[model samples]
Target: MDFRDHLRKIIHVDMDAFYASVEQLDDPSLKGKALAVGGSSKRGVVAAASYEARKYGVKSAMSGRQAARLCPHLIFVRPRFERYKEISQQIRKIFFEYTDLVEPLSLDEAYLDVTVNKFNFPSATILAREIREKIKAKTGLNASAGISINKFIAKVASDINKPNGQKTIPPEDVIDFLEQLDIRKFYGVGKVTQDKMYRLGIFTGADLKLKTLDYLQEHFGKSGLHYYNVVRGIHLSEVKTTRIRKSLGAERTFSENISSEIYMLEKLEDIAEEVERRLKNSRVAGKTITLKLKYSDFSVQTRSKTLKLFIASKALIMEETKALLYQEPIKDSIRLLGISLSNLNTEQPKSVKKPSIPKEEQLKLPF
Candidate 1:
């Protein structure tokens, strides 16, 4: 299939180590130094790591103690989330100049559909280069981009050339590209899935393509169909401009674990207030209240109850959560407590329809 004939021009742009880069940009002294953000305390977890720290095998989500062991001189700094959001908004304004079909994945990454851009430019490649240049001039930061016929391939390719590079996989080469891709490197293949694929001799896209639909479904369930299609260069997901929030939640990890339910009530009240604030901001309500607890040993437990009517007030939310919390006996000291509301009144998502390609179509060979 010639994606040029039927596919959208998608570009995935990602900021390089966003939080660490911003910190370095603000403090010149931190530039070229091993840096980690928000991971100094004994119980703290690293939110982001700079390239220099990464060279020492430091990574986001690593424990502060472990990161310190990896890179002894790594500098730890608090995260200034407001500043990051300020810069993210500025970057998005630049995206709007080219196309309104921008889907932000996070503060540092987004998917842009430039098939019909403001400039009417036929080459999405040129647009990507220009966008990155504009972002560099505006933020003094480097970004990487992946240009392709779909969001999944674009997201994967963006990571191929990191920091300040970009990779473009044209429609004609997509099949070959996916075929040669490492199973671990596929966009959604996590370690557990990768290991499973390895056991099944599905080490590459080509390997995966050999598996029959029935065999895959029996082994991997619903994900089997997705793997079968993606390897054939047939992804139907669109770049959504607005994502639906299925659930809203607030949680806190306490410095000390509480062994008594009575001691947890006050903490639950504070969390309920936060959840109410978030609900008020979103102007939405839900019928389900779920209470999540993480034990001192890192195990987790959740209890949920669905109400007859959607409720958003803190009083009602707390009342429902308290009932669920007290319904079950506390088995262990709780280190974390969370409350989430689902079955929201917000608009539900509609499935995207597949393209009108005939069954006789074949992927264009790069040779």
Candidate 2:
């Protein structure tokens, strides 16, 4: 018997344009209209965009000015995070009714291991549907779900039919499903990696499967082996029920890149203060301070220092961020600045195995 048949059933659930949807829900006047939730200021970036806006090429992380140019009639609303958080809690309560093996990736997306569920259903597909219905009934928002043998496939599958949809990849179909997937659609493949893969003639899972394991390893290091296994539909990572807080960070993209050290340091101080406030609110302290700089050319660089003691004070965080910022001379005009705290006090759960491509390496799925 194929031992793979015994794999745990996993489900990935994602809310549909959560913030924008909520705005539409609470105010019926906004229904069926293109909407984006975020500051509409010159330097503001979109936090979320509704499906209607998406049709016009609006997207999250796009600057408000660019979004306006893309969708002439796009409506911008400031985010109400507290309201979104309240709805998230309501949906999570429904998830817990089915399984305790829930790992939340963000306020809008989560993974659940339902191989053995509270309802005693053998079909994860059914559970996913019922949970989505419950969410809609309780929150008046649409959610999409994907059921598969592992988190990776399930998460990717969730995007297949988005905005109130679901898809399931049976165990027997895993290999074929992946073979047909586009290289750009793979979970951890960013623009840089995608371009590299294109150069290597790996454009699909089928193409990736043609390379030798040694060849992959030689090219991509440990992550190469990871890609090899994923293409073959083999991932051993488990759904983590208890997750540690990895980092607390905030970033701001500017309307125009700034090259002046004085201006850059001023922005860093603002980011550091926000990060400090969030750390205190969460009651977590960290020893590592990271400074993220995004250049005008779109290239990104991060500098980090792990201190001997955990500190959550704004003064200390700013002090460290400034040190890291000044340690290296400004190379180019910077378009963004961010500050983060990591190496937190919470312990990593032993039940879940870390992926070969670290969480930091994985790009947030567009879905």
Best by TM-score: 1
lDDT of 2 by residue, 1-367 (tens): 2316336688999999999999999999999999999947455779999999999999998878889999989999989999999999999999999988899888999999887678777778888999999999999999999998788899999999997999998877888999999999887899999999999999999999899999999998888988988888777778887777888889988878899989988887788788888998999999998999888777889999999999998899989988998898878999889989999987655785432323342222111
> Each prediction's Cα lDDT score?
0.87, 0.86
The 10 consecutive residues of candidate 2 with the worst lDDT sum are 358-367
Task: Kindly give the stretch of ten consecutive residues in candidate 1 with the minimal lDDT sum.
Answer: 358-367
TM-score of each: 0.90, 0.87
Clashes of each: 2, 0
Tens-place lDDT digits, model 1, residues 293-334: 989777889999998999999999989988998897899999
Tell me the lDDT of model 1 at 33.
Answer: 99
Query: lDDT (0-100) at residue 235 of candidate 2?
Result: 78
Q: Which residue pairs collide in model 2, if any? A: none
Off by over 4 Å in 2: 1-6, 252-270, 293-302, 328-336, 352-367
